[model samples]
Target chain A: MGKILQKPTGFYDKFVRKPGTYDQVTHYCPGCGHGRIHKLIAEAMQNLEIGDQTVFISPVGCSVFAYYYFDCGNIQSAHGRAPAVGTGVARSNPHAITISYQGDGDLGAIGTSEIIHAANRGERMTIIFVNNGIYGMTGGQMAPTTLPGQITSTTPYGRDAATTGLPMKMCEIISQLDAPVYVERTAVTDAKGIMKTKRAITKALKSQKEGYGFSFVEILSACPIGWKMSANDSIKRIEEEMIPYFPLKTFKDEIADRTPRPVVPVAPSQEDVLKALGHDQKEEILFKNDKKFIDDFTTQKVRIAGFGGQGVLMAGTTLGMLGMELGLDVTWLPSYGPEMRGGTANCHVVLSNKEVGSPVVESPNVLIAMNEPSLVEFEPSVTPGGLVIVNSSVVVGKCKRSDVTVLEIPMTEIADSCGLKAAANMASISAYLAFSKVIEKDQLVTLIKAKFKKKSLIEQNVAVIEAAYKYVSDHVRG
Target chain B: MTNDDKDIPRVEIIPEECKGCELCVTQCPKDCLYMSDKINQFGYNVACYTGESCTGCGICFYACPEPGTIKVFKK
Candidate 1:
């Protein structure tokens, strides 16, 4: 038997690392804002009492290992994918206080789509965007936040507005969105700047604890190495140059109050938790026949892969939740990579009566690859006698293996024709379901509408799903 | 937790370092830290040290800027 060591008490005490523990001795240059921002965020988490219920998403950059200092459940995102992953985390675990930390290059460049959409959708999470005016991690490169006339490796002779667009104001952009409850731009140039930064960081965190949707804090930080200046000079630049352009102020704060909601205590003996799990948790369940999938099938692994913004994960999760509603064992595992923002994303769904052996599917029985790249990437792994569905717009070739059946459907064209481009992802997923002959149309339609609460979206998605079902029935000749 | 019981830690504000952002004064769990009438070498009206009651939680240190400006030692 292994040794049973004694661990520490509550998460608070256990998480409090060392005196100078600032999230793995951050990769920031001397006098850089990353360390200060990290400390302030950690402190805010501590003060909010949401430390235990917090899950941080750190984008790939200098501070990728923000988890080391955060002392919480951390999801290290592929470069620029923090917002997408944070969206999933926040949506799945509504109780968790989700935080996404991204550099200017990560957030403003590759992650622009995810950040904008998440802010537009009003996800209840906190975003601490570190805008140091240049890409510090990747050898002092030009970033989206690089100011005019600011020289870097990418912009050697100083940025010219004629050549490069104006330095983006992310807080201003985010403030335009109605969903975000709070958006602020602050700096850490001087002692006073640090004070304002602390307040902004703390306020943004508090908004998340209060269930306010999408709080964003853009922190103008120092980049000593990238700015080609000494530590002291960088601070001076932040005061003299950075602050004038990115003024420190609250862009938007829609929250009625910043205080956290009081947790209502319950006497344990009085209420039934089982009933809450079974009956009170209302969600749509998808299954065929009177018997639930969990009670019938031993196991089922579903893989759905597609380009970014195609609702691939959403479709898989919606189906997974349907399985849950049918009292079937279900798990929705997301395939995350750097291609989250307008590139590609995927999810694996498992439905089973017994416990699943492995979540990773080297040879998935059912595969839905939206793009040509995804098919090329995942096609070799489809098991013989399995079904493979590819998006028609991208996939045009035949497979090498004849044992597996490949069903090509014009998902994008169909969705566009149906006046629902977003439904293309749903269409591909429905095609897989149709070919598999698992879970009938009526039940799936019911589940889809329930998952897609919007009436118009439900109508369009249902049409898209039905069209895919019809296409699968007509096409795929043996 | 009341201010009357004087067992809290004392807060020291280094005027030269304090930018007068009021983060400490505003964020104090107990509204004890305040600006003093006296001025420091920086010529800015700095925050005064109030030792009546304090919690040695080092929250002020976490918030303060000057590396050693705000120190909290137990009695």
Candidate 2:
């Protein structure tokens, strides 16, 4: 009797659960290459002693039961999302070895975009792609890797390149990308072929274990039952048919080894966080106590809408910044039209004493409409007792809703008079704050002073904002 | 009696683990291994040893797709 090699310690001795219970057996069909590939992967992980630290992400299609086999951390991802899931696991657990195992149907079709983006980012992970050239899970269907004359359930008349396009050469396509440290394609049909696959799996896993960036090992496997061929014939077909189109290759081996980046010595402090983000840099210099503070309000939903060049979003941001300074929760959500729009821009601002759920203000308590369309669109959604501040210069129509308090201020005209027409957003914000008393006048002036860093514009902008305060007080208060 | 402990290769096939793909049958240079009509518990016809001529080059051990299915002991 010869010595027996026990199953790789990385695998559970038995797959006991499900439709059947079997010890030391996989659910793969006869002549299917998944079993052989699994053996190679487990051997590599065991050799590297990374099973405990490895997280396997399995997508849809065959091999989705990866958690049932490899005795490691396993996550079942959506159809095309294994790579994305692997990225999250790798980034969060920097010491962990992440593996994304996928079938051709899952990766080549629905997951094409995700794989491309993940490879572009060079997430530290190993991707094992099993290409059997047909969709195995949902019955043999036309896959992106299905050959030209190959007939599947979908392509019953054989694949037409004109109608369905040619089979994607994924290994060659992925190798063209710059980030992957290693890109290879190996088969498992013959003894020599299986040996090649084993070596390729080992190297791919080693790349991840050494903290190398993305490495991919794609295996051209066979599906005898689906191909309607005998086990021997199926193995032969890979050598005769598949090898011609997808030549066994190592498209990349090792990149110019990158110098390991030095670890960060110290965590940045709270002060550093504020300084780097340019937030709260100028300390608690409050608005002057010249105006009354609104202590009664718990939450304020403000929507500012205007034309693209009107700086409408900045007006909402100033309020958002003020909410942060006041130790209140705030969110600023901007809505910019498409690049070709050359149209309108809007922002939704939510300021609250407690946690805010949705940043979108569906029915706002305040609507600052700077143009005719904005007033026409948002005037109906304002709360009955809420404020509707309109820039009378550009917005010609009046607010037909008499339930809300509508204040028509010639903000654009006033900014033009001040020779700072671009300062209309700041002027409008200052006027709204002056009337609402959410923040005092001096604090508003302090924020303007602290926010604008330009020498000439600081004074120029502050003058326009103060004029807004004076205009609101004389016209509305009188 | 002095030749009792000979340094010859002894090959073993875990009958239960063999998928009966016959990769070993094709790879064995000495033509000592063949597929038998007998089926193992996994329901596939298993590979059998001829017990006649095996140089034990370890080709079958390498060729068997299932890990640990074949082993060559030189003792």
Candidate 3:
């Protein structure tokens, strides 16, 4: 006698990925519809020969472990993001058939926008949406597809549409979109319904394999544990309660007439990507640093604080970029209030000879305080014998701590003399460089020229750097 | 169809994998499948097949949710 029916080759021979001793069985409860649906999909995959090229995107539900069963390229996406992730996979690998397997709570609730947009855009992917009435993995919470007046854990009383709105009909919504090639709503309550579901799944996958646009199959499934009923009763509930609200039918099927989507070109190369981002590969050597300045400062954790428009973040970025140009490991972390101009702002700049462990600078070795309030707030966190550069133009107070060296510079007046007030950040950078001797004075001017494209602005910034360097040498050192 | 016992169609249910949902037992038209009282390691009574009048219909194979639980052999 010949073997008529057996497990499909789409499933792993032994579910070694499944945890626990029962690798032979799924993690689903007894008589769960997920097992039936999974079997049908696997059978379809085996029959279609797309198992090797299929990318199964599992959602954040009980079926989150679908990767354990489906022996294909699997990606466990965040809740409701399967469609978005499926779009990426299908677009990136045009020959690969992507399956976004989602559940009611995932597709209908949190992932509504993702599903709608993915379908609307007509991404060449198949979305298998399992619409059980209640949330299964989360213990019978009210799902967007829950039947009206159906009692759930969240709805202690029966679900009242006046308050929580009616159950969402996703197939109806998807079929209304212009891009979908096939949209069907099937069930898995009986053998006939299961067969119909298999057919619908096969058709959906076929549409995707042929490069047809979006295809969706919403399968009305049963949740025995979530419904607080036996497997048999849950199947009956699907027939008697769920089918009336969600009628089983093909809402749209254009696969027979639709043409395959055009093949997407391969991704761009690294040099092309850099060029697209406005960077020339040849100019990369402009920032290359020789090791001559490495001994001046092996590492520096600098904190710059000021009002929003005072370019605190810009100053930190300048320092970080200088360190990066020197071939040192650097990180710039910005923290600012919600306002556009006047709110408090600060950024931490870390420059290290080795890989910087953490970007957060709790106790900075260098503090650039642009205003009096910033100096008062951040002076205490400076390490002993650290350097504090105060913007004496904006600050009227004196530094109380005698341990750390304080350099009070008129940054605003210096920037004004250089013909741009915003260039005060460049002045601060020049002062830091001059005092620390981390890099030569001309290096800061060259960096300014490389950073600013406008001739006038570059000239003014260079003037500010030179003037600030002169002030540091003549006033602070003298 | 042969009258020989070995030549007749039948189904074999893996006792360890059968979850005892009884969907197969209820859906079997030939009335050959039944739930046996022998509990397997996971502690549920598993479905069993009768030796006679087997038509080899694959309804029970599809009805049972657990994959590889039921394998049907046809005449």
Candidate 4:
């Protein structure tokens, strides 16, 4: 009888196949270093006996497919954001070991500040940085670590160092800081080099497992296809050109004399958690458990669209808060990415008796359009029997849809008469509720009094809401 | 499990898992592994044993990156 040498338990037994077939092969090009680096990491996880406690954070690059190989907890981060994600995972799951694996473009170009900040804070995690001199995944683009005079798809004329500057050495930059218990640079070209890389990977993981602070291992790898060279020539290039510039060495290793990280969170007891949440659970849950509110038929799916300064999101939030106060399930979703001021902004609000499955009011039952463009964009999406409130002061055009009810109110004009143009949101909401009979006017007045304390402001707001409602009711309803 | 006196170690390559990287062939000290002439189901040449030497050092196993691509057995 004889024993057969199989792979380590750190990887999935088989690869995910296509829709109809089972294929276990990786799509990586021949002589790529990512596969070799993955092997070393898997070996380290096996040798250190941390496969169960390991969590791998992979950012966008060749290593993003790491979850397919490693049988550990995996998280896919946005482009160049693995270090930030790994920091959160490490601090929250203190006992678990975190590994942040990234490539040259991810760490050197867009994610420079994220890695620097994470390392400066001394996050308890290990980073395996693969520097292949070019962006291999995104069609051989020029990365920040591309060597001077290296020819790539972007730098076809041979990289101009005088204009583009030199390649970044991450190990040297990280070692200059006071934190980071261990830092090393290794390669995987030959048998001896592979052995050294395995040891370096083991050391980095060990440092993280021992509760030491930040650790990083930068591996100078080869991308033969991206470099447009054969496997043999790529290995020689690592020795002749790459090794001299980026030497393999341990820049920092004080694991034997390092100090344990402080301030690991201790889980609070059940009574303490309950006290912090609420001492009187019965009273707090009464609002959510009301039968009459949940069974009401006055549910509204509202879409508020306008320019950013028009308080579209604030209007949605106020409506949602009122829904929650009246014992209804509410959801508010804003549709803007950092373009909130002076640009087009919109929000979707759902106040329903049943559970709200989605917060997207694609065909809104109620639309409050505060501008002409907003009305033009969202008017056709209203339900057949829905209500659309248009700001007639800014929206001069009439609604073309014949199926839905249209209530055109001069919201800005009423707000101007009420002494503040910012009260347009109050006017629109008040008019919609009064016409639809969704909520009692007395209840609204009581709630408004509880919210605003100043007498003059309350009087102006009440006058605007009432004025908009009376105008809409008299003209549109009659 | 004890090996017989006349037993020698050999390698088995699952053709589907091989992408013809030639990593194991370069790492093998005995010149035993080589790429086959025909391609597999994935349209890439797979590795094949030369049957010239068999030391069973398992260096080829370590060099092959894709897990479960090659298995070494003493028979």
Candidate 5:
């Protein structure tokens, strides 16, 4: 019998995603270690029969286009976020063999938090970290794994350990955590080293397949072009210079003694999720048939603007809640500045019979201006035939437009008389209900009673709403 | 020799896919691989088999970086 060893099934036959005319060869430079490591991982995936269930997360760097080669499910993550993304993939699909392929510049520098937390949480994934001592894709700048006294573009005069600190030993750092099942540091400088690296990668992937918690393998790779050396010279550097600082050995191996992690529980049902979120379907039914006055207001885009302390956002929320109670589609978006009390704040409320397209109300059909600055700022954006409700207690200017109907109500003065000046937002909502005849004033009062927690404040807010409704009916509506 | 050639261990190297890195040539234990004087479409000399001392150890297959460049058959 004859045995043929060829390209593994994990790699695509034709790299269709690779740009230019080349389809068979990779974009890696001659004798680049990334290609060797990739071949080893691909062979492992094929031999383990897990290629069909794998999800390879390609990181930013020279291997950013790794998705073009690996035939399994591929997701190109942001710079240094492959571990975090792999966590999501592994957790969501527990049967998936998730692999996070990263580089030194990505994992050692910006993605340190992501890798540390993922390993600490014992995520079921395999991380193949390629450490080339310098940034390969970004033109050979000094990296977190760069050795001391190494000359890079950024470190022109040999890296000074006093200023730049020392090269990070990632395998040592990751093995210190209690969660990871296996951690090894290997190289790809020679045939023996390559075989060792292949075995380490295979072990890491096999542990992941058996649900044996997190596994990480740091491969000391060579960057011939990035290091400005011949391919053979680069391999020599990895053997003589890199191996002395970053030694090659298995740092942690708990695969033989550790038990398989428990399977994740299934997600909750939709009804149970709704119940957990405090949604009551029976209350929605109570107001669904109360469409008697729903036809009075047709699709109103309301804008509420005032100082930050004036409860402008609270007014918009009340309007949105009222629309939802009426069984209409609604959306509310609030915009505010840094200062909590004095800065400007505004909110947009969309109430529609059909599904609302966008929540933003660029040209509002109704404007509730609680201060003079708010009136001056948002008055021009109101539709011509809309209604304007001005809080006459604070607004000094009169409504200059003649096309739209304007209501001048002393909302703060009315609330102050009722002993709670903060209840002006309640007065504003009641005035709109009374003037538009959209819903009964008692509907808003019931909502207020249900919303407010304090007994004394509930009574005071109800009094303000009743007084404002009467004031609008007796003076403004007349 | 012609009849025994069918059972002898051998390797096949694709010319276009080879990057002339000489990794397989240098790493082969039997010294059966060599870089040709001619170049392929990418203007780099490709590796070839000497076809005499063949052990079929498959070390060359692991040393080469590009996928589908080397295929080893053992008898």
Candidate 6:
């Protein structure tokens, strides 16, 4: 029999964990707006019923222990990269809801590029930008959002535009972007303010669940410790000071009917790959679901490369699992780097009939390069007469080597033709099935369909896969 | 465990002012303070704890950064 622990009624046992509940104690200074903002966000997540699928990215500062409070998948990111990391999660698994919680110092300063670019890309995500004027986590340093004439650790006397520049208006800047479908600036200084902030957070979360692109809610939080004021005084300061500059208002709300869009292909990023490789300090800040695949004795090696949003990694993961299901050893290797690419992106997969040692595919037996760069990077490594699949639209230049049989197919055109714009994943899966002949076509489709959580998305992807198979079978000959 | 317990200092948490930051819970040497489901005026859970279990250590009081949230009194 298991030991039982008892507690008082109305006490949330799930809220507490071993070594004590992470929420039992908090780090925010008294009167700090962070606590209120955190509560509001948590409540909104609970109300939305996305506690399981939701992934929260915690930024450096007073709210670093967000994982301890939010009862969901938690990724703790380095200062300012929460939005960037959240973007990766949102783009990779469109089905899961991703939330980034950040402070003025983390988001407005160090993460300016990541935040601005993410919003500009219109990546489907919900961001909670907490602006408390001063950097609470770092002991009251002057943040970019610090109000003019405000005294902080850095700005000893007062923030002067001539010397320190004026307070930055982030919400106003975010509103200027064409991609942000929903943007709001709210506060949590008082009871009424907390209510408004909660509404804004819930609305943003709803938009994200609906697959609306880039919903941002900026909270005019308070820094009671930094301000050297009482909790009540902090509330008074918000009413007297912060609200005048960052007014509570909704900037954008453009989605029609508010229903979430259908399954979208994953966007694999070099940054996401780097984090996956444990290169970043906050590597653990990624939302990795349960091991999506299980395997046996054989080994599998694969390479997938294509334009940025083609679901190269997903296809590899799907295939990696399929190989595992067949009792084969498997290795899935994705690319890691930074490049301003509008073309194709790629990933490598290795599934072997035996024990596999290395996951990196230096020379692969089967190669699928979706763009020119990937082929150029991987083609030299393919063995003689090895199967090489390239997107016909991108295989503009000659494949200098004739030793390898290169099958150029209009994969992009095929995906677009199937009413599934991002069906390249399905196309690649089909090609790999026919080329390797490793597993039956029906088996592979069943595996992929089971992986797709949504019933509606399965049909669209299945149609694309069938079309891809028909194309490969009719055109390619062994 | 006796009437002498009443002789110890007591710590009180202001539910209205508490944000459930849990800073006090982590810093409590005896591990006493915690987040309570007791709803506040804001309709949210507030961090709370009874003073009976307190050892007069004043750790929770010092750890609480929120003003007017944690108060200590000598019994």
Best by TM-score: 3
> In candidate 3, what are the lDDT values of residues B12-68, reduced to their tens digit?
899999888888888888999998999999999999987667788888888888888
Which tens-of-lDDT digit does each residue in A155-229 have in candidate 5? 999899999999999999999999999999999978899999999999999998998989999999989999998
DockQ of prediction 2: 0.27
| Decreasing TM-score order of the candidates | 3, 5, 2, 4, 1, 6
lDDT of 3 by residue, A123-147 (tens): 9899999989888999999999988
lDDT of 6 by residue, B1-75 (tens): 343555566666778766655556655666667767787755656776644566666545434444235665544
TM-score of each: 0.49, 0.80, 0.90, 0.66, 0.86, 0.49
Once fitted onto the true fold, the runs of candidate 5 whose alpha carbons sit more than 4 angstroms away are A18-23, A158-165, A286-301, A305-311, A327-329, A336-346, A352-408, A416-422, A436-463, B1-3
Deviation in Å, model 3, residue A181 alpha carbon = 2.0
lDDT of candidate 1 over A253-352, digit per residue (tens): 8788444433333233323664755544553334444565445564667788877778888888887876776667688889777776787788888887
Q: What is the Å distance of residue A278 in model 1 from its true position? A: 24
List runs of model 6 lying over 4 Å from the truth.
A1-23, A257-262, A267-478, B1-75
- Sort the candidates on lDDT, descending order: 5, 3, 4, 2, 1, 6
- Looking at model 2, how many pairs of residues clash? 4
The superposed Cα distance between candidate 6 and the true structure at residue A352, in angstroms, equals 25
DockQ score for candidate 4: 0.34
Q: Fraction of true contacts kept, per model?
A: 0.02, 0.27, 0.64, 0.46, 0.65, 0.02
Superposed Cα deviation of residue B73, candidate 1 (Å): 3.9
What DockQ, between 0 and 1, does each candidate earn? 0.05, 0.27, 0.64, 0.34, 0.69, 0.05
Which candidate leads the pack in DockQ? 5
User: Which of 2 and 3 is the better model by DockQ?
Assistant: 3
> Could you give the CAPRI-style class of model 4?
acceptable
The DockQ score of candidate 5 comes to 0.69
Error of 5 at A186 (Å): 0.4
lDDT, candidate 6, equals 0.72
Model 4 interface Cα RMSD in Å: 2.6
